[model samples]
Target: MNTHPAPATRETGGAIAPHLRRLLEFVEPDRDDVCLDVARGRGPMPAALGPQVRHLTAVDAMPAHAPGGHGASGTNGRMSTVEFGTGPVRIADGDTPPAAATREERRPHPLGPDRTLVKADASALPYRDNAFSLVTARFSLYNLGDPEHVLRELLRVCRPGGRVVIADLVRGNLTGPDRDRIERLRDPDHPGTPSIARLTEMITSAGGSIRRLDVFTVERPVEPWLAGSCDDATADRVRRALIDEVDGGPRTGAKPRIIGGELWFTQSWAHVAAEPIP
Candidate 1:
């Protein structure tokens, strides 16, 4: 039997994470609204959301594919339980996988009793149509193989006049044949990053009307970021490429440069909110 390596768990820290706060601003959920967060890896957005919405549901793709599950072919089966841990919502340095928060840990939360968690595929969400007042996916598009399908599903579950918000890293400065190859080497499951223009096209094509779009640039250190998934050799190569960018030797569009004597890269993130045509 052949076995594949485990998918890289995206590091959920850095100043970029707080952009959800700005994205969620578009939703402006009321105390009565129902919210669904799709592809909510590691729970940063959900954590920020739990306190504001009257009810919340968070879902993620299980680490392993489900047998006869919601694949693109339209097969269906019961979803298996996989625990996606929760943590405090804040942007800071370092990767920390908070131990799965207990019910006791969650009780003090405002919407704790009303929150539900599910591990399933994004392409086929389990909820019914017009079920939620707001739907959001953060930092998830690049990892998903079919972002358009996921967007359509997001629109399907949203109530009439409800909003769908997405926050994702836009490919910046990094260009060339080698960019995708280097990223794949670091995290094999990384499909590839998308440009902002492509993302806008996907959202609009999925039958959503754009309400707001915000883009922000963030600077993050490279070594600590790469170390989360890459082996020594792979990390070495990535570091070399980034260093090359610093001296204008090559352009990976990772926007690498030396900051305070430490190597860092820049990424532009987009937060867009759209509504399905009523």
Candidate 2:
């Protein structure tokens, strides 16, 4: 099975930063409102999101992997978890050890008293019904057991007319061969990402109205792409396959396009904003 190294924490953050910024503009949270960043990996969004809203609550299913660390077994050491909130953000640190105990802690952003970190599942949020005015999930739904169910839960927790925005990678966004290889190698635990059409249908069926939907594509150099995944033999195979495909020829209608400094790979993405029905 083909495999790639998990993206470096920095690259992961960079990959999603532009997308998150665009979504934030559309969501437009006010200083008096509470916003929740569900499945917040490494607290990247919260760093930008904390100052915009009155309070920002960040939660993850598992404690973020210690930065620069290796594996789930803590072989490379642990990273620090920093809380950033306006009026006391409540953080829930699920099953992972507290950030303090980890050996590889990154310094917390100085956002001050309003942030709370919690260990929680998106489908079964611990907050009260209608506790938040806005909810955002960044590239997380694709990994959940039931993304639609989580969307319903996101809708349920939002106050009437509040908005829930979802940002995720779409299936057609990656290089064609790379995309196929990924699907073949992907574990069952990693559910395939949903297409834009399905996501829209799920949100509408859940009694939420889509206010805006947009797609953005980015092309990255091959080196960075190869560097992003695991460094194992399987990962090497996958990387080679990707390179061969790119150099071999185009099977999918159009030939590969060159962008920036590398042979281009396309990433199709959609951002959907849904408002709950009153």
Candidate 3:
């Protein structure tokens, strides 16, 4: 069974991702809104939902394809149970798998009439101020350093009254940082995952007013999650760490457990929706 990952679409594994579906609903995209998705890690979002809007552009600092002659495609995806975690909405709404090819980035720019992929930095976007109605930075924020600077950039490009959605795997104090340590063990490129409150605070500090906040708990298998994120040896280490935690060693914060004899863990993600503080 292939474990490496490819960017997931709405139709990736023959079914719609429930979390993604809920996210789109929170975005509340309009037919005329121009959108920007930054650092599309695990999902080819613009490619999948491009036609749904006027135009959607995705930017990533890294190249479209992974380095060192890797092939495209992964094990599709694993079924997950997405449960709403927390946060109260004022009135409005709203992870990577591996290093794999996405249909948007590899091909020439403008994947379709309404979509384009560019290699750009989140901190220094190559766009005019207030150029988009909606800007999003998914699982990519933690991978890039300086959350405040990036959040400000995202808001700068988003026109006032427009919204910016930030989402990522958030770490909790009670859970500890062990899970994130394992994440770094798999891929050292990630700087850090911030707590849920920290992310929202950054948005406000970046000149954005919080409109809504939603958190979700995603339950998925541990093996598949590690498959493409790291090599076999590193994966083994991660397994040992999680297993040790399961064996009453310490809290991993990953909440690892056995489900039908398969190792599984739950990841908590936060989705913050905010508009410019105009």
Candidate 4:
């Protein structure tokens, strides 16, 4: 098992995938929503939904190791800013200067008063129970190393009757090819994308009741997909495997093909909405 964290499983950048509009429409983030996005890696859920909601809190799984001490004291980690289009979203970079905080200093956040960036483990959020009106996790779940425990924590922080939205690159159809293997080839830390059924089952098991589910496909380019995270040699292997699969090799689940003289493949995604049972 790879102990290091994996890079974004699919595409990078802070932009949300277009197909997610359907899922966002289904849940419909409201201005009254105090949302929490768990395991919100480089995936675009938080950036996509933050503008539509009142306040959004994003949780990153990366460990914060404060160096020599430079951030607010007592903070889980230090603060760093990443531009998410609408505004800059602050994220914890694992260090903070001692809080010398007299009476819990409250300063206006440059990232806007509505956005909050927290540095903590997904399996263990520092928030109180029933704190957020919306708890979501996007493509970042599979990287946590333990999705189940993290799911439970997402439900725990969510207020009863609040919604839990999950969107991810799910596995292919029931009897389809083995997409997981192809993904693992690209990301060694990957633990196989789960099926749609498994995703819903996890939500229910984690104390949330299913409200809606949707599936979509995205045609991904081969070269950039490999270039995003894989080293040269690994990329070559993945390319060969995909090409071989295209040439009657065993099904790799990734439906690789040539389009307009460009190598391409497809990824199946699942967007799920669940509500905590009161």
Best lDDT goes to which candidate? 3
lDDT of 4 at 211: 65
Q: Which residue pairs does candidate 1 place in steric collision?
A: 173-253, 174-252, 174-253
> lDDT tens digits, residues 1-278, model 4?
22121222222225333355545665567788899876533434566677788998876554222221011112322112211122111111211111111111243222445677775777777899899988887665655547787788878888876777787777644844366677777767566777788888888888888766666655656775675434788889888988898888977777787656666777766677777776
Report, for every candidate in turn, its global Cα lDDT versus the true structure. 0.62, 0.55, 0.65, 0.62
Query: What are the root-mean-square deviations of the candidates from the true structure over C-alphas?
Result: 12.3, 13.4, 10.0, 13.3
Query: What's the residue-level lDDT of 111 in candidate 3?
Result: 57
Candidate 4, 46: how far from true, in Å?
2.9
The candidates, ranked best first by lDDT, are 3, 1, 4, 2
Provide the lowest-lDDT 10-residue window in model 1.
70-79
Q: TM-score for model 3?
A: 0.76
Q: Candidate 3 — which residues are off by over 4 angstroms?
A: 1-14, 40-42, 62-110, 173-175
lDDT of 2 by residue, 216-271 (tens): 54333334443333445644665455556667743432223444434434445566
Write model 3 residue lDDT over 1-278, tens digit each, in one string.
Answer: 22222233354224335566567666666677799988744354665456667998877654323341000112312111224534321110112343322222445443576677776666778899989988877676655546687788888899876778877777654555556787787667656667777777788898988877777666667765676554788888888988998889877677787766877777777777887876
RMSD of 2: 13.4
Give the alpha carbon lDDT tens digit for every residue of 222-268 in model 1. 76567645468877888898898788787876767675677876656
For candidate 3, the per-residue lDDT at 220 reads 68
Runs off by more than 4 Å, candidate 4: 1-17, 63-110
RMSD of 4: 13.3
